[model samples]
Every structure is written in C-alpha cells, then in structure tokens.
Target: MTSTDELLVKEITVSRQSSGEERRLALHQIYVQVLERQPYAFERKQLAKIEADFLRNKIGVKRFLRELGHSEVYLNAFYYNSSNPKFIELCFKHFIGRAPSDQAEMRRYCDILMRQGVRDMITALLDSEDYSRHFGCFTVPHAWAEASYPSPRTFWETEVLLHELHGRRGWIVPTMVWHDLQLNCDGGSCRLPEPSLSSAPSSRTAAVISGSEALHQVLSTMGPQDLAAFAATLSTAERDKLRHLLMQSVQ
Candidate 1:
C-alpha cells in the first residue's frame, strides 16, 4: 500500500483506541502529522476533509490553535494575508467558549502577536462589521484591547476624569477601558475640568489631578519630601500610571 494508505491505516488504529478523548486527540495528532509529513499530498479536497474533521472532532479550538500555532504552515494558513475567514471564524467561536486550553493558547498567540507587532491582524478581525454575524457573538477581553492599543491616556482619559471626580478608590483604569469609554462618548467630545481651577481640596485627599499639559506643573511644584509622601500614598495601579507618565515625559 502507498504512504497515504499506510497513514489511513494508522489513523484507523488510533481512532479505535478505548478512550474517546484519547481517540480524538490521536486523530488531531494524525491529521497534523499527515499535513507535516506529506504536505504536497494535501490537495484542495483533502484540505477540506481535514478542516471538517478538525471542526467535528477537536473539542477545543484553543487547543487546536495552540497545536497549530507550533506549525508555521498552520499559522500562515490561518493568519497570513490570504487566510481563510471562515476557518478563522470557526476558531474564534471555539475559543470564546470557556476552555482552559483556550486561555493558554490565547496567551501564547497574544505574546506572538505582540512580539511581531501584528496588532493590525487582531484589530482587523475585531473591527470587521460582519464579525458578530460571522462569529455569532464576540466580547473582547480588556487585556486584548490594551495590547492592541498602547495609549492608556487616550483610551481612559475620560474614565480617569470620572474616577477623579467621584473620588473612587484603588482603581487604575486600563487603557482599553479608557478607549472604549472614549469611543462611546458623544462625538469624541468629553473633557475634564482643570484640577487646579476646581474647588479647593480637603486635607485628606490622597490624589491630585492635572491636565496633560500641567503634569509638568505638578512635578515642578513638588519638593523631594512631598514627592516621596505622595508616592507612598498611591495605589499600585496609580503608581504604574505615574511611572508611565514619567517615562513619557522624559522621552
């Protein structure tokens, strides 16, 4: 028998294994092995069959994506410019379901995307007007949103203002949450009142606010002892934001 026939025979043996989950896992391995070992044999018809098998048998799209993530051929097939949107939609649906496997795979994929600066791919997928129609439903994770756009200030500026206004405690708004708030605002027209011009603060106030331009004013006005005192009272989230702002100012 030919190699293709031999592979089919091996697949049959694995499929007949006692455990259903093991059998399914084996089938996925066999499919990946066939693609890797004899890629030239994968004509359009065979590829279609492979995809169907993956959809029917693979319990977790995240696990499948993780397996496929290890294969450059697979990644290129799904994510390259001419990648198939139908297959991507299938993967997205599988991922959205609560799967520990999905979370691990997503973390891996996000890391890869971040390192490659391929945020455009994710944004394009999310921004597609037909995304909901194609995927059924979609809700982006806050981390994904933040990674796609790094400018926390732009996205969360209004949220920050609101937090300041309300005297909310221990909340450092994420950049993506900020972005969503801004996008949802009226005509991109939301403004925070100048902190200096606002009513006088109580002695117990733990935070101060200033316009983006007045950040320098706040820093220049503080002595070393006051800066240390202020830093001591800030939450971790607030401290991180302050560090980010300091880095931006220096740059």
Candidate 2:
C-alpha cells in the first residue's frame, strides 16, 4: 500500500502509454485522492469489495469512483467531520478538481446535499457534463481548473480551497465565505456590519474579531443567503478595492 505522503506527492495521472500494472497503480492513487489521504486499515476493509471488482475489470473507474464517494467510510472521513460548506468545498477539490465554478453551481450542490443526501450529491457531480468531457470513465481526474478560475473572487478563495486540507476537519473557517466578508482595514482584524437601522451596531451583534481562526469561528456556517447579504453591504468602490487586495494578497 502507498503511504499517504507518497500518494499526495503528485496528481494521479494515467499516461496514454500505460497499460496493465500501471493502470492498477492508478487505482491506488484514485483512492488516495478521493479519500483526501490514505485509507485506514478498517477503511480499506470496507472498500475491499469495490476494489476487488475494479481489479477484476467488472466495473469501470466511474462506477468504482461512485461507490467510493457514496460509501459510509468516505462520509466518515470527508463529510461527517466537516461543516456542510467545507464538505462542499472538499467535494469540488476531490471529484471535480476545483472550487465551485460560480455561486449558482455552489448553491445547487448545497441544495442537493441538504435535500437528497450524499449519494445523490456525489452522483450529480460525477454525472455532470464536465466530468464526462474531461474524464470519461478511465482518465484520472486532476485539478485542471487550477490554471483558470471561473471568477476573480474565487481566485482568492483558492488560498484555502486548493491547498492540502487540514487533517483535523472543520477546524478552520472556510476562506470562501471570508473572502467576501473580509473587513476593509489596515490592521489584521475583521468586523461585520449589522442589519440594523441605527447608526450604532447592536452590542450583541458586533465585536472586534482578531485572528483568522477567531474570525472564522465568529462567522462560522454562512449559507448562500448570508453570502448574498454580505455582498449587498459592499459599496461599488469597496468591492473594487477588495478585488485588487485579494489578487495582491495571493501574489
């Protein structure tokens, strides 16, 4: 079995010239990528049947991948420990190989996960048009979208979304939400405006948030509606400055 460290050294790829054993090796890499790390011995035991079927050529990579995604073992590793939003982010990284293409795409998947459960959610992504075009059944999925992000704002979110995920799931706030909500300040702190009519913020609703971890906890678990509300608060000029700052910060 490949170590998790070795599996993550590079994206899993099956070169056009490969056959037989090389293709088998590609299967090992696929498991690492999907699980976001090496599987525990018990986890491997859970997946033994699926892996056996794949080894026997009884199923294509697509079917093998689908079973893995919907497996309870996978849910325990990636989804159960993560916040809903973080799980969605990881899903894009794991299966589709990028952050959500747009807010609409993100919201749609979130809805699927909430309404229909993991099986349907994973199925939607694997069966999507883009998956069919680039990966088909045999090709290993890679982060091809890393070269071209769909939105300028999403580029900043690449900071957290595209990197190696923390082993401790749900430990950090998602940068995807924070990117839009970042307070305009020279100091390294954050604040959010209240949805109130008075000039002063409600004592309960406002406070000085310091450090990324603190801020993440303070604003933890925002949804699609919360994002829209946050965007509405930004002035046109603030939005432009944010765009400029976000790009600069990444560089």
Q: Output the number of the TM-score-best candidate.
A: 2
* Candidate 1 residue-wise lDDT, 28-135, digit = tens: 543443233233444435345444545465333323333443345544443442112222222332222111122233344334344553433344334334333323
Task: Give TM-scores for every candidate, taking all chains together and pairing residue i with residue i.
Answer: 0.22, 0.64
Q: Residue by residue across 58-114, what tens digits does model 2's lDDT show? A: 777788889999899888877764556657777777787666765557667868887
Question: For model 2, which pairs clash?
Answer: none
Which candidate number has the best lDDT?
Answer: 2
lDDT of each: 0.33, 0.61
Badly placed stretches (over 4 Å) of model 2 are: 1-19, 145-148, 167-172, 183-251
Model 1 TM-score is 0.22
